[model samples]
Each structure stands twice: as C-alpha cells, then as structure tokens.
Target: MSTIDHPNTEATSAEARVTSDPVLVSDVVRSDRLLLADNTVKNHVIAATGVSLVPVPLLDLAAIMGIQVDLMHELCKLYDVPFKEKLVRSLLTSLAGAAGTVVAMATLTSLAKTVPMLGSVAGAAGLSATAAAVTYATGRVFIQHFEGGGSLSDFDPVQFKELFKAKIKEGAQVVKSFKPKSTTNTDQTAQTV
Candidate 1:
C-alpha cells in the first residue's frame, strides 16, 4: 500500500510568520503622503476661511455598521462625538449658505461672456435667478440628507436622552463644586459686608 503525504499548511504559516518583515516602508510612506496632503488642504481652507482646522471624522460608517471596535477607536482618536456632530452641522450650513453666491457669480460671468448680444443686466438677472434656483435645490437636498440621518429620531432615543441628561447633570455638579479662591481683599470685603 502506497500512502500520499500532504504538506502541512499550518507548519508553513508558522515558519513564514517568523521571517516576514511586517513593517512595510512603502505603506508607511504612502500613509505619510496622504497625511501631508490632507494637512496642506486643511491649511489652505483655514487660511481662506479663517476657521480652525477641524479634522474629518475618521469613522467608516460601513465599519461601524459591522461593529468594528478598531474603527470606533480610530474615529474617537480623530473626532469626539460632540465634535463630529458639530462638524456635520457646520458642513451642512456652509454648503447651504455658500451655494447661491458661488453659483450666481459663475453663471453670470459665463453668460455675459458667451452671449454678448444679451445686455449685461438681463443676462445677469437671468443667470442669477437660475443660480438661486440651483442653490435652493442644492441646499434643500443637503438638509434632507442631514435630516435623513435621524440624529434625534432613532431606535434608542429614550436611552440617549437619559444619557444626555445625565451628562448635563454631571457637568452642572462639577461646575457647582468649583470654588474660586477668595483673595485677601475679597475676604476683607466679605467681612465688611
């Protein structure tokens, strides 16, 4: 009787782990470049907008849905819950507010150059109205998207509300406990009073 010997995969995997250089420099370099690019864009926006640089929330919604703790940790490192909420609100507001001005100027400029026969005022007004409609539609869509996320209306609204209330109560307690040291002059004034 002849017996066929199969190679053991587990032993091979164990042997491979010892020799593998897990730290890949190319991957590190790429990640560093991405970080640099992100910083550059953030700096440019901050310089132009005069707003503090708020990092984008690092949570992958897909990963969160899959219940990945590592992704949650990564997100916490990038943005806290309150800051993430604030960032979303800020983005929504900015997109809603800026759409009209940008669209109006671009459309008017384009129309004015393309159809010289149409007097500037008429062309500008037509373009401006078109831009306004587009902006309104865009803003509405953005708001709808924001509201669709249901930050307030959810399965565990009661629990979340209680948690929020508890946090506020805790904060109030902490504030109440904080006592500013009375200076000598303040003590003297108190004594006089």
Candidate 2:
C-alpha cells in the first residue's frame, strides 16, 4: 500500500489555536443598537391601537431580530464559522415563541382598546412594558449565544428559555431606567424659556 504524506502537525495546531479565539466586536455599538430597537418597539407598542397595534410589536421585533442576525453573521465570519443566510433565517424563525409573546401583547392591547379609557390607562403602559422586556430578552439571547461561539445549528431555544426569562426581568429594569427624550427636551426647553 502506498503511504501519503501528512501535513505538519505544528502548522495544524497553530491554525486551530488562532481559530479558537473569540472574535472581538464593539459591545458598545451592539448594546446601543439593541437598546434603540427595544425603545422603538416600546414606542410603537405605546402608540398603536386596535388592529394597528397587533402588528407593530411583531414588526419591530422582526426588525431588531434582523439586526441581531446581521451582528451574528459578522461574528461568525470573524470566528471562521459558517454563516449561511438560510441558517440565519432558520434561527430567526425559531424565535417564534418571542413572536407569540408579542402577539399576545397585541391581542391584550386590542381588547383593551375596545374599552374607552382602559386603552390609554392599561394597555399602552402594560403592553409597551412587555414589548420592551421581550425585545431586551431577544437581544440578550442572541448576544449571549453568538459571543459564546454558538452557531445557528448549535442554537436550541428550549435550552435558552430559562436564560431568556431571567433576562426579561433585567430588561424591565433597563427599560425603567430609560428617560424619554421628549421629557429631556421639554426640560431643556423650559430652562431656556
């Protein structure tokens, strides 16, 4: 039997070492984007009503999820992992539970809208808060998974459910901490006037 020449073990080991390291991206930028998306969803959830409200959170969530997927794609490229569009789409679709949460929020908001005063009093605040929490959880999940060298194939939503629930509580705190820009602007205007 003819023997084939093997490549240098040292070269293979060096390549493995280089590839194993985590890719460095700007966490600040990522966090800012995630926050912006969460705020946008919150705003939309607050402003929308009736049938219009049903889709707003879902749409915003989809947009934010898209951005997160793009961020993941960049990380995958840097980490020398495969990043296929199909895989990204599959991962996004697998987040149906989050979408279902948004839908539930929308349904509640719609029912609340049927009542005259309850729409503004209960639905807006409650649904918007839920929207913020859900958005935050989604962003956090993607960040944690991608940062931990997880790929689309490696993702398991069932395994992440507990972490996502914990993150929702943290997200509520973050949302509570956000001071609306309109309030800040009004304060500045009052000072100037």
Question: Candidate 2, residue 179: CA error in Å?
Answer: 3.4
- Between which residue pairs do clashes occur in model 2? none
| Backbone collision tally, model 2 | 0
Model 2 lDDT per residue over 84-153, tens place: 8777766655664645665466457545645666564565566556655655666667667766767668
Per-residue lDDT for 101-192 in model 1, tens only? 54344344434534444444444444333332332232223223223343312213233333333433343343334336657988898999
Q: Which residues of candidate 1, in runs, are more than 4 Å off?
A: 1-109, 113-118, 150-193
Candidate 1, overall lDDT? 0.35
The window of 10 residues in a row where model 1 has the poorest summed lDDT is 49-58
* C-alpha lDDT of candidate 2 relative to the true structure: 0.59
Backbone clashes for every candidate come to: 0, 0
lDDT of 1 at 86: 42
CA lDDT of every candidate: 0.35, 0.59
